[model samples]
Target: MKTFLFRSLFGTFFGAFVAVVTTISIIYFGSIEQLDSEMFLRNSLGSIFCGWFFSVSPLYFEIDSLKLPTQTALHFITVTICYFVLSLGIGWIPFSFPTILLILGLFLIMYSIIWLCFYLYFKNEAKKLNAEI
Candidate 1:
């Protein structure tokens, strides 16, 4: 449906933007130092994509109104676990703490942004649907 597609796309875009901004902020805050621009960009982008994928995966399923909270909690737990695991795995690579934090921070930011976008989109869609009736 249009609503589903809209939410998914919005989520993805919002996630990526947030991840980029967070990465920039981390760099600005001196939390991360980069010697190689290409590697930093690649890791940041990868984190963003991973976050978006996990965050949006749960919403693909349909749920009743009453079950929304439970579904959301499950989604959060799953995403957090996955992100942490992925971050730790990435840390094993030849990167410093700052680099690792920058990557993980971007991932968290993406997750937050996607959730916010989904919330706003769903709220607006619900309102429109109600108005149509």
Candidate 2:
């Protein structure tokens, strides 16, 4: 619980920092115009919550009773829902069916790639530990 809270706080602050930097950089580079203060705060808070949830998302996998696939599915679903909502709230994505589908496809691809990397890395680590044993 303590670890989870710490991770959440760290991610929240980290997300806020990244949000500020990224937003400012875009504005500075002429990629986007400066947002009014209210929109800026809304977007920043959305991103902060995103970071907090994502940081502790891996904890779902820590449940020994659930199989890996179940854990993955749950984590994927929860993250996707939260992120889609956040993106809409932050005005990063529009509220439309086609755009939502496209975004969902992108999320699927991203999640698959990340899951594969973690799976491969952990398998390698297990092999190393077995060899030592």
Task: Give Cα-based local distance difference scores for all models.
Answer: 0.69, 0.89
The lDDT of model 1 is 0.69
Error of 1 at 123 (Å): 1.1
User: Over the stretch 1-133, how does candidate 2's per-residue lDDT look in tens digits?
Assistant: 9889989999899899988897888798976755778987888888889889899898888899999999999999889888987898778899899999998999899999999999999999999999999
Candidate topping lDDT: 2
Looking at model 2, residue 4 earns an lDDT score of: 91
Q: Model 1: clashing residue pairs?
A: none
Per-residue alpha-carbon lDDT of model 1 for 1-133, expressed as tens digits?
6665666677667767876787788789866666467766666666666756654657634666637668767777777676666656655333577876776788678878987898899999999999999
TM values, all candidates: 0.45, 0.91
Top of the candidates by TM-score: 2
How big is the positional error of residue 16 in model 1, measured in Å on the Cα after superposition? 15
**Could you tell me the TM-score of candidate 2?**
0.91
lDDT of 1 at 28: 91
